[model samples]
Target chain A: GAGVSQSPRYKVAKRGQDVALRCDPISGHVSLFWYQQALGQGPEFLTYFQNEAQLDKSGLPSDRFFAERPEGSVSTLKIQRTQQEDSAVYLCASSLGAIIRSKNIQYFGAGTRLSVL
Target chain B: DQQVKQNSPSLSVQEGRISILNCDYTNSMFDYFLWYKKYPAEGPTFLISISSIKDKNEDGRFTVFLNKSAKHLSLHIVPSQPGDSAVYFCAAQHNAGGTSYGKLTFGQGTILTVHP
Candidate 1:
C-alpha cells in the first residue's frame, strides 16, 4: 500500500564531492527507473533496471553518474565529483512488468532534491 | 532534438470549461503516450494515457486522443475544476522493449490555472 519513496529529501553537496540518493520501489515491482529534472524542465531519463539487471544507462549525463539495483527492489543513484551543473531533483519511478507488455502507469517518488554548491 | 514537446508554457481557464493540453513528439518510434499532473512539492501523478493502437481513450472526466500521423496527442478534461490546476507533463516511450522502462521521454510541462 506504500508508494515509491526516496531518501534524503534534500541533499546539499559541495562541488567535486560524491553523493548517493536512494529509492525504494513498491513491493514486487520488477521495473525501476531514475530521472533527473532541472528547474522548469521535464524529468529526463537517467537509467533503468529490471530487477537486479540494468537494462539501460544511456541517459546518464556522463561517466560520473552511476546507478545500481543490487537486490532488485531498492535502487541507488550516485553522482561523483558533482558540479553546479549537476544540481537538480532526482526522481525514481517503478511499475509492474505490465508497463512492458502494455501501457501501464509509473508510480513516482517525491524525489531527492540535490543541490551542488 | 526534443522527442516530446509542450509548446504552451501555461494556460488559464474558467472552471467548468473544457481544458485541452497538447503534446508533440518528433520521434516516430514513440507509440505509447501518457499524461501526468503535479502540484508543488510533489512528484507527478499519472493522469491519462493513450497507446498508438487506439486513436482515443476516455476515463471519467479525462480523455486522451492520439494522432499518429501528426505525432501528436492531446488530453481533454471536461468541466475542468479548480482542483485540476497543476503542471501537466506529456510523456512517451519508444516501446522497443515492449515494456516502458528505460526510454520514457517527457515534455517541458504546461501550467494550468483553473479559476472557480
Candidate 2:
C-alpha cells in the first residue's frame, strides 16, 4: 500500500471479550508503532517495533494488551478480556527506521475504532 | 503524568485570519516536536516539526515556534481555512540513549474551527 492501512475500521466487543486489530504499514517501512487514543484525547503510544523486534512496550496499560509484528510487516494488537476503559481508536504508524533524514516521522492509518459494551 | 499539555480545548478563527495553538511540556529531555492534524474517524496527519536546536520551522502557511526555556511550543496557521478545522495535537520525542528513541509523547489536543 502507498500508506499505512488498518482493519477492521471498527470493532465492537463486549466486556470480557477479546478483540484483535491489524495494521499494514507502508511497504519497506522498518519501524511500526501502535497508539491508543481515547475520546477527546491525543494518541498515546502503546508499543513500537523495529522490524520484527518489539523494542518498547512500556506504554501499554496492562498485561492483557499484546502486540506483535512477526514478519516485520503486518502487525496486530490483541486485547484480552476487554474493558470499557479500553474503548478507543487504535492507530498504527510506520516510518523509515533509523534514518536520520526521516527522524522517525510516522505515517498513520485511519485506525480501528474499538467499542467495548 | 501528562508530560505534554494543550491548555486550550478549542479555538475559533475566521477564514483568512491566523490561528494559533499552544502546547507545553514538563519533560526537558524532549528534543523533537511535531504537530499533527486530524479529522473525526481518521488518524492524525503530520503537519510540521521543529528540532530543539532551532526555535522555528515553517512549511507552507503553517509555522511552528518552540521555546525551550519555557518548555512551550506553538503552531500558527495563516489564512485559516475551513478545511483546516479539526483536532490538532502536539507531540514530542526524545532520544533515550538507544534505539528506543522512536517513541513519541503527545498532548491532549485542541479543536480548531475556522468559519468563513
Candidate 3:
C-alpha cells in the first residue's frame, strides 16, 4: 500500500468486551508505532516496534492492553475488557527506522475509532 | 506529566494572513521536533520538522522555529487558506535507552480555523 492501513474504521464495543485493532504498515518499513488519541487530545504513544522485535511496550496503559507486530509486518493491538475510558481513536504509524543523524518521520493511518459503551 | 503543551486550544485567523501555532516542551532530551496537520476522520500528516542543532527550517509556505533554550517551538503558515483549517499537533522525539525509548511526545494540539 502507498500508506499505512488500519482495519475497522470504527469499533463499538460494550464494557468488558475484548476488541482487536489491526494495522498494515508500509511495505519494508522497519519501524512501526501504535498510539491512542482521546477526544480533543493529540496521539499518545502506546508502543513501538523495530521489525518483529517488540522493542517498546512501556507506553501500554495497562496490562490488558497488548500489541504485537509479529513477522515484522502487520500488527495487532488487543484490549481486554474494554472500559468507557477506552473510547478513543487508535492510530498506527510506520517509519524508516533508526538512521544515524536523520529525523525519523512517521506515516500514519486513518486510525480506528473505538467507542466503548 | 505532559512533556509537550499547546496552551491555546483554538485559534482563528483570516485568509491570506499568517497563522502561528505555539508549543512548549519541558524535556531537554528531545533531539527533533515535528509539526503535523490533522483533519477530522483522517490521520495526521507530517508538515515540517526541525532539528535541535538548527533554530529554523522552512518548507514551501510552512516554517518551523525552535528555541532550545526556552524549550519552545512554533509553526508559521503564510497566506493561510480555508483549507488549512484543522488541528495542528507538535511532537518531540526522544531516543534514550529503554523499552519505550525512541518515542514521540505530543502536545494536546491546537485547532486552527482559517476564515476566507
Please provide, for model 3 over A1-117, each residue's C-alpha lDDT reduced to its tens digit, 9 standing for 90 to 100. Answer: 999999999999999999999999999888899999999899999999999999888789999899998899999999999999999999999988756525567999999999999
- The deviation in Å at residue A29 for candidate 3 is 0.5
Q: DockQ (C-alpha) of model 3? A: 0.74
Local accuracy of candidate 1 as per-residue lDDT tens digits, B68-101: 9998899999989999999999999776763344
Per-residue C-alpha lDDT of model 1 across residues A5-91, encoded as one tens digit per residue: 999899999999999999999898888999999999999999989899898888899999999999998999999999999999999
**Runs in model 3 lying further than 4 Å from the true structure:** A100-103, B97-101
Q: Write the per-residue lDDT of candidate 2 for residues A1-117, one digit (tens) a residue.
A: 989999999999999999999999999999999999998888999999999999899989999999999999999999999999999999999998864724668999999999999
Q: Which ranges in model 1 have alpha carbons more than 4 Å from their true place?
A: A99-103, B98-102
The number of the candidate with the highest TM-score is: 2
Worst 10 residues of 3 chain A by lDDT: A96-105
List fnat, each candidate.
Answer: 0.64, 0.78, 0.78
Stretches of model 2 off by over 4 angstroms after superposition: A101-103
Pairs in steric clash, model 3 = none
DockQ of all candidates, in order? Answer: 0.63, 0.75, 0.74
